[model samples]
Target: MGICDAPARAKVLNMSQHNGSFGCNYCKIYAPFNEDLKCRVFVPTSNLQPRTTDEWKKLALAASNTKITRANEREFLGVKGWNQLLRLPYIDIVSFCPPDYMHSQLLGTVRLLLAYWLGGRSQLFKYNFHMVWHLPQVVRQYGPLITNSAFQLENWMGKIAKQIHESKIHIAEQAINKCSVISSTITNFYSNIDCFETEFIKYF
Candidate 1:
């Protein structure tokens, strides 16, 4: 197979540098696995059993009406239902989503999620962005927690953000190299469908 058109298991094992426009360590493991041809696997459900008639009726009623909010956390479980409804027939939302919004939101989400999964916020890893983009917006959306981070503590960070704002091609490169929070943010981003989309889907 051609580059990035191989098996997931094999791609991950390669661990060598990826020859691409952007140098991503994770892509060395993931890019090749994504041939952009194979379909996503359907998830098996509840021992592959059917819901009883009343269960189906209850679900139908639940689906027709509801607005989700943080106050009504349980209702937002609807994201799983949305995922189930859309998983088939191809659900690649990447191209459909807004590039600027995604660019601004994705990096932060990925790092936050990783921090929670690996252990906690303190256990983040270092990454290397091309330069940076809408970090102020990300910090605003995620809360003030990032304000206390070592990555944001540098005196020159304001200048870096200015650079990102002025030159869209560049990004917050050094933040990832020295800060573990960036990695944690990445993992956190992919963990929850609802939380992620709710916080930043307008960009998409």
Candidate 2:
């Protein structure tokens, strides 16, 4: 149900229909519906399963450059039965194609800000600029729902950065470690607190 970027939709569409020759698992057409509309679902000719990295890369490329005339349907179709690649019913694919708020809102905003500040700078700035891509993985590891943009880990990172700034820490790793220690201490403190203490603390 969660999609990271526009490429995800493309991948889904590609899987649904390999080029224009094959039918889609979710929709009848090769193209996706409008942003406000939803695509129709249909039982796939084959079963779904995990694909190799090369296959996924090809699919991604196909999705991005849709004009490429290629009939690689055999590569995507399963041996038999409905594909279980996503483990979701065919009907749910359209509803699940919702825009990813974390990418569209939080990450997009941060990326724009970074670009404005360091558009054409040194290699270090370029590296720092691309570091935003790692954020989603780090956030997912912490067990937060990726779909809910409001609960993004970037907010917490912002707070940590603010603390780092206030502390005048020259080293990034030390600041990150400080934030980790602070978070663990707070979590441990709460874990031992009684319900009454929790309520009292909430009022403050």
Candidate 3:
């Protein structure tokens, strides 16, 4: 599943744990599975029964008392919620959520670039620059380079936005016209390949 780290790992799993604690949702060595563990939002897979608010609060209280050692803190934090989710038959939660390159890489990079050009030594610029500096290390933890990036999607959408602005057409009609223009252009380009070759040969 694609999700940000703080919400998925920290708030969900390590509730009440010190913010600086190095905890996570996945490692068995750190947070071993226990049947006795409680969760505020427990959902039984078989019956799909929902726990009462009071029961959830009790679970949360119990979970808060569960001792987490510094060494295995990360694994222990989110066991309750993680285990509960695992019992559900339909949803197969992956061990790790893929880092969002769209937000963290492409848009992040653009933000950094903008900060460099426009921020003019402001604190916001400094913060963005710092993040940009650490981006490579952050990406390395996730996996290989992203094959597709937000840059392409954002750029295409930006062009569409510009077209909409220039055309001053109704939004719905602009969308239809844009698609029609693109399809017609592609068809015409392919159909005129022989003509293009003839012109190329004559020009040469």
Candidate 4:
């Protein structure tokens, strides 16, 4: 599962960013930026439908086939082009890749919601608040928390960085070797965990 920020997710999926008209990954709604409120607001419609993996692939493929300078513009949908990740049959490009909760919620959604409640734009606050309610639907569809988070990824990255003793030379090789060693250590520990538990019980 690819857990990243909205912008990073967009880059990975080869789609438009969050601020774009068709930016929402889950909803196929055209959210235009309201200059007065300074944010993209979704217009509620009876026929609003959730984005499906099959639909996404078709749109993405069509966008890529356009072969224009601005292919994303050519396509009404926000899809830019085909991504290498699409080759994996198991990974549903729509559902598998979820934005990290911390960045998408705490720093993004919650922050904006708070701003609305704090009385910046009193007249349009209610309308904007209702528009932002699509988040709950997203959570229900994708789940509240993903398998991975930014913190966990950052920690792993730090460990990998520390494993490299040299500055620039053979860094990739060193990282791979270090990761292999770590993986083996973890495997061995897990393989012998039952034996260790039995020994502990016998001795104690």
Candidate 5:
């Protein structure tokens, strides 16, 4: 490399060298086999408040970080590209940000990704759809899109950042409800046991 410009693969560990790596030196970092990769999915459950540039940046960041984590998710889960998230009714792009500044960067980067996802990479290499006809052209539109709660941001997402948020309680409630069914059934059995015991006592 040049004296001024830094060399590629300059890290101490050279994460791109491992097998099963979708992460190439030129683009993706860290080998795909980096299995211990921790991932968190952050999707707002509701619409957001009015955004300043800063707030909008945070919104975008969540999605940006999610995209990176998704690579790991795809590898570990054996899924295809990010299209799966698109199909989910309430799932949005996700990311992990322990600190706020890191959060903001994700937002900023997501804004960049949204642009790329739209606009056809370069105009010469456009993403085209030859489907039902007139609607297909309209359906494929992309660009700045609303970052709604993962449950909300479905179907075609176009335009720039739209306020997307999510309900953690709703998700929690569903989780609780899902698991509690068995617990509730077990509880009922115990509760009815007391009644049965009293009836047997009376009979005896």
Candidate 6:
């Protein structure tokens, strides 16, 4: 049920970011960076198996236990380390989360296609038009994305941004910590609502 952009998804899952090898969450797809294209290109493969939550935990644990640096990396099965979310048994740490449509589709594919078509690169982009090609499959897997897209959640960013001081040191950390505190406070208040009502009755 986590709806987030690519970077946030990587942070929450403690996995490789979108640009890294084996960065995909749904499948074990290795996307290597194409220097000429200036982006990671996913080589289509049919035999790759979809990632499972159990497998994700195992891989994450194995990656964390090792003294793996750059040279000895086994791609870590796309997992860098364990996340707090993994500790929750009811949560599906893999497959349940899908990439945000706003970032992945509107900002990414649409912008790219627009740039190509409007910027007079349409002929050149014909060979590089795989972005739109995957839409149907993505829709099939995740359902109609407009409902769960990041559009609604992103509205809070403007308000949260205004809270930051001019110093701007650790801005993201400050925002996240503030959100966590707010969430904890709300949960605590609701959990103790009956006590509050009793105290209110006595006061009146």
Off by over 4 Å in 6: 118-143, 159-204
Local error of candidate 3 at residue 180 (angstroms): 3.9
How far off is residue 132 in model 2, in Å? 26
Q: Across residues 27-57, which tens digit of lDDT does each residue of candidate 2 receive?
A: 2223322233233222232343323333444
Report lDDT per candidate.
Answer: 0.31, 0.39, 0.40, 0.65, 0.27, 0.66
- Report the Cα lDDT for candidate 6: 0.66
Residue-level lDDT tens digits of model 6 in 1-204: 688777888888988877666677777766766777776777665565678898888888988898666665545767898888888889877755676778877877677678787875432222123324444555555455564467645654555666666665687777676786556554654445445455545744
> Considering only N, C-alpha and C atoms within 3 Å, which residue pairs clash in candidate 4?
none
Q: For residues 84-168, write the lDDT of model 5, one tens digit per residue.
A: 2233344322211011111222333344456677974422111011001122222122111111111121211211112222556
Report the Cα lDDT for residue 6, model 2: 35
Q: What does candidate 5 score on TM?
A: 0.14
Mind giving the per-residue lDDT tens digits that candidate 1 earns over 1-204? 011211221232221222222123211111122234332222222232222323323433564465544455233222212223223344222111111222222444466566677887432211222112223433454323232233322323444344344344334554544345544453443344345445564654
Q: Once superposed on the true structure, which residue ranges of model 2 sit more than 4 Å away at CA?
A: 1-147, 165-170, 180-204
Query: Each candidate's TM vs. the true structure?
Result: 0.17, 0.26, 0.28, 0.68, 0.14, 0.66
Which candidate gets the maximum TM-score versus the true structure? 4
Instruction: Give the lDDT of residue 100 in candidate 5.
Output: 17
Worst 10 residues of 6 by lDDT: 122-131
Model 3 per-residue lDDT tens digits across residues 1-204: 334433443443324221232122222112222334321211212232222333333444555566655555444333333234434455433323333456644555466566667955322222122234334544444333342223434445566666575455778788777886556554654445445455545744
Candidate 1 local lDDT, residue 153: 26
Off by more than 4 A, model 1: 1-64, 78-204
